[model samples]
Target: MSARARRWPLVLLLGGTLLLSGCGLFGGDEEEDPPAELLKFKPSLQLRKAWSARVGDGSEHLRLGLSPATDGTLVYAAAHDGRVAAFEAGSGKRRWAAKTRLPLSGGPATDGELVVAGSSNGEVIALRAADGKRRWVGRVSSEVLAAPAIGGGLVLVRGVDGKLTALRQDDGSEAWFVQQSVPRLSVRGTGAPVIAGNVVLAGFDNGKVAAYEMSDGTLLWETLLTPPRGRTEVDRLVDINATIRVVGEDVYVVGYHGSVALLALESGQVLWARELSSYNEFALDFLNIYVSTETSEVVALSRRNGREAWRIATLLNRDVSGPAAWKNSVVVGDFEGYLHWFNAANGELQARMRAGSKRIALAPLVVGELLVAQSEDGKLYAFSERGKR
Candidate 1:
């Protein structure tokens, strides 16, 4: 593959292809962009492991959207073996676990009342957040490759068929549906819809971002982050498979072979756009935004105008997870299950910790005080930093 062809999952965006063959997007041969060798560095910060637990047989080599999420107190996570569990945010105590018995892929979204997760077979399983009892099961159009969004009396799920289906919170029933046209080639997973005040924002595989009314699924506005190019479909891919972030009144989204642009919340208008290609979600704070590029370069940009603050290519081709910002530090995991923390002010490597040897495919979730990560083999870990090294 040429430099222009170095994009994400080149598989045909079929309904079920992503479930089994997503490893193609995450791996390559020795000749094509070999994994970058890691450089040894002294630890400057003490990132002690808070806790670790087995999340059950996890996604394995598949590229699933299962990640950890938290509601202020309890942390929730799901796995491919139909296991969804809740843990105490601080102590890592096993609160509850629900076995839905579906090939679960996306989510375990929580709002303290209900914990919801999606399946690779288009099933949305909702459970009681208190006891992990199964509440309701709803079906979507196709495979759910992303986490469902929970808010506003509705649970929003984006299926691989390009449909965004909204289910009633109390009972799992379809309330409204809106869908976009899929491209010939797309990445494996889809980004979860984000719920703000009255609007829910999401990006699609069609290289566009749209906003819809959370009340009745009305289309608010749509903006294309970038237009696809090149004679080959590989070069023209602009899938926004990574979840978009909404900060106050601004929305930030990045895609494969597309521009990472800041958009106005009310209207899907692009405020500032920059040419940076990525398929992973980002870590955002009051000061700066951090993203892991397609080749695994961690770059920090200004939240105001998308200006480059600093970047480090030491982890290139390591298949780094998306960055997580906590306590003025940026955290990311690599294919080798090593968690690296960097100084937010500059791109200096401060500390590193190995969770295991499995690949960490998703971004670490910063829940209150602890930073949580999940490995491909279904292991969950929590880390917290201290002043002493």
Candidate 2:
């Protein structure tokens, strides 16, 4: 990857003195080339704030994956301070809340039967969806950074140490665990395991995506999506921290400093690959794939052939979150708590709003006619179209 494609800012030394971050960490003078200022655009969609609630004491800007989740009826959210809560999907009324005191950081994934959340300390807890009662607690080998995948009567937790542990959904006992060889220097997060049919798919720090049989944990197929290269550890980084998306029998995988590729779900054959890098999550609809690139460029690619369709770079260098596909638009949050909506067909700015004062780090969730997003300070906001209510 070229320096321009680098996700993280490069530190440079000139004339025996390190360039201070404020002066030029962005590869130019900060004053002269600041993040693209939010521009004025005519409103095409009137964004309305529907309801807002708090989940817990907030993530304190740790960038944890405590996004809001839903099972078509209720919204589930977790906080870094060990608070998990469920709300009525439409009215935003609190259903139940629990205090696990385990530094909840990863989840709140629901299967409409059980709600599961993981901690920064490698602990997984499942709660009864009916009353928020604790059901079972399972242990893993590393910090669980992604939402646990629940399917086939099992909970698959993606560990930061490149391991995926399957626990029994009934009692939280270990069913199986698979550890992949990790690179010495890699990104800190892991892609959540995706369950499809009888197979569980996961990406690793070494830039490979593998599938395992859900029943017996047998290796089914593995494909190297990103091949590490260059001389330094940072240059060779190829962590696939982005969430893997599956549509029917096709799997979508993207890695940091690597390429985004579509693979055959059963045979691990590469169908199409595009040179795009993202550390954040992605959203897809029937025809297009939305991705937030490392430098905060929201891009749309043709889902069928991996061709570029559109890109919105007005928010570059702003630490933007991944894009979420809502009705006819793509929504993304930035470090400053602003959510920008773009036309799904042509990338035109449709609408923008400030959901909160703190950063919104996760892709917003879509439930019914409302769009839900969680900020760093544990604030959950649901937005609607002007006439959605």
- Whole-model lDDT values for every prediction: 0.85, 0.85
Q: Which runs of model 1 end up more than 4 angstroms from their true locations?
A: 1-12, 15-30, 386-389
What TM-score fits each model?
0.94, 0.92
Write down the TM-score for model 2. Answer: 0.92
Which stretches in model 2 have alpha-carbon errors above 4 Å? Answer: 1-33
Q: Put down candidate 1 lDDT per residue, 1-389, tens digits, no spaces.
A: 22223323335556445332334443444346567677887888887888888867966556788898888888888889998888988888899887789998898788889989999889999999998999999999888878899998999999877889999999999999999989867776789999999998889989989999999999999998999998876688889988999988999999898888899998888899889999898889888989999888999999999999999999877878889998889999987899999999998999999999888888999887788999999889998876321
In model 1, the worst 10-residue window by lDDT is 1-10
Distance (Å) between predicted and true CA of 31, model 2?
Answer: 8.7
Predicted candidate 2 versus true structure: per-residue lDDT over 225-282, tens digit per residue:
9788887776787889888999999999888889988999989999999998888899
> What is the RMSD of candidate 1?
2.9
